[model samples]
Target: MVIDLQNVSFKYENVNVIQEITAHFNPGELVSLVGPNGAGKTTLLKLISGTLKPSSGKIYIYDQQSHNLTNKKRAVWISMVPQNPKLPDEISIPDFVMLGRNPHLGLLQWESKEDFNIARKSMSLTEIDYLSRRKLGEISGGERQRAMLALAITQQSPIMLLDEPTSNLDIYHQIKVMKLIKKIHTLKSGFGVTILAIHDLNIAAQFSDRILLFSNGSIAADGMPKEVLTKNNIDSIYGSEVTIITHPEHGTPVILS
Candidate 1:
């Protein structure tokens, strides 16, 4: 397993936000966490990324317990694109993306040619290369989201966690970014495990190798998209009526309002 959570539970202000989530994310898998608002999906991602320690139980990244690892060591194993990242307005896009290389560099060392090359390639892969010289303050929200994703890609970690990656993106960029993420997961030398907290069920059903449905701070369902994304499951968890249909091309479940 690339990422493992063993009976993990977390509390904020003495209230449980994540309740005993025991799951393993396998290599080369793209897993989507789906649920309604306040389902703890984002909180779970934070726990896995070691940004938030669990109140109880364990989180392991490639056999090393997250709580025991130093912040730098943890960064070497996981790279995360947060839902609402705080960008430095004065920093140029390329410079911002290059910060991802900090984890691999020695304390006194600067970004090497290889590091810059990796950053450039990540920008290209994310189609943000054209904005390389632009300051973060000049970019649109959607563009900024892509830039953040580019930075995460440049980190070159084995496990990638994204919170609402498609948020703020229009339909075109949403599909584009999702496709790029799918391709990145398929890359043999790149990320081994990709986990995303997403709200768009259709996109999740189409791209995810597996889907985890979260509800009330727990995993309501966990399985392949076809197995977990049924009409009954959606209705039960979301408390809303949605029709489930098959995609014409891929035959995956499509949630229709």
Candidate 2:
């Protein structure tokens, strides 16, 4: 599934939030959207998730147009993990993840054995099976992040859209989450694509197959990690002097301030 956007512009109350942006995200790729604070990362996620339609131009998931994709159908195709989610405190992690199955069920349908199996498998994939019985509020921050990823996995969408999936996690959990994302990307099954709006440049470089940097409501740079995360581009968009060196072990771009 190629997410093809052409001159896509989004506005709020006559205020332009995303300017004419054109880009293509290919199938079976992991992409990271990176930028400074208030660079419209969240807004772009909303647009891609079918919450907001572009004011001008077009967005296509495969050959289908964005406006034609209803929320119900879109939810089935793309699962999103938001920056901050308000999970009900009393709900267990497994129960919370089961909610992702709503897209596959009828309005009056009840949870079936298959649903529980899917939810259980998702927990296993995220390595959160031990926390399955724990209340969402009782879990640690990293556990909560993993729980959210479990929910996303259970949704079983071909394309996953995540907003700050690693926010507030410790370094260990951060690496864990990135590795899980990479695992999903390389699945033998036809899980198509994954896109995330992230803040950490180093993780973006390390995990993402491609990086798109936004500035002034447009894509300032788009390419592989090595090609885009240069000293000049970082200084221009982030407005800070920084040096970028290749990581000795991983060969990914490492930025030093």
Candidate 3:
């Protein structure tokens, strides 16, 4: 397993945001976390990224206790594109993307030519290269989202975690971004893991190798999209009736209401 969560739980202001949960993420899997609002999907991503420590239980990344890894070391293993992250408005897009290289740099070391190359390549892959000179504040929400993804891609970590990556995008951009992520996952012949907390059930079903359905701080279902995204599961967890159809081309589940 690339990541192992052993009875992990997290609390915020005395409320259990994430209850005792055990999960494992294997390499080369594109996993999606899906659920209704306040289901603790984002909180779970934060825990896995080491941004928030679990109140109880443990998280192991490649068999190493997560808490024992330094921030830099953790960054080298996992890269995250947080939902609506705070950005430096005045910073150029390229400059912001270069920050992704920090984990690989020595203290007081400036970014090198190779680092710049990697950043450039990531921006190109994310289709944000044209916005290199623009300040982050000058871009649209969708543009900023892509820039954030570019930054995470530049990190070159083995695990990528994205929180609502398509939230700010339009239909076209959403498909574009999702395809880019899928392409990146397979670039190394399925060498890494990409996990995203996404609200779009159809998108999740289309792209994910596995689906983890979260409900009230715990996993309601876990399995292949076809198995976990059934009508019964959706009606129970989401409290809404949704029709499940198979995609003609992809053969993935399509959720309809």
Candidate 2 TM-score, C-alpha based: 0.96
TM-scores for every predicted model: 0.97, 0.96, 0.97
Among all windows of ten consecutive residues in candidate 2, which has the lowest summed lDDT? Answer: 184-193
Query: lDDT of model 1 at residue 22?
Result: 94
**Candidate 2 — which residues are off by over 4 angstroms?**
188-191
lDDT of each: 0.90, 0.88, 0.93
Could you give candidate 2's per-residue lDDT for residues 8-69 as a string of tens digits? 99988988789999988888788999999878777888898987879999999877997898
| TM-score: the better of candidates 1 and 3 | 3
Clashing pairs in 2: none
Considering only N, C-alpha and C atoms within 3 Å, which residue pairs clash in candidate 1? none
What are the clashing pairs of model 3?
Answer: none
Candidate 3 lDDT over residue span 1-257, tens digit each: 89999999999999999999999998799999999999999999999999999999999999999999999999999999999978889999999999999999999899999999999999999899999879999999888988988898899999999999899789998998899889888874777999999999999999989999999999999999999999999999989888888999999999999
Estimate candidate 2's alpha-carbon lDDT, on a 0 to 1 scale: 0.88
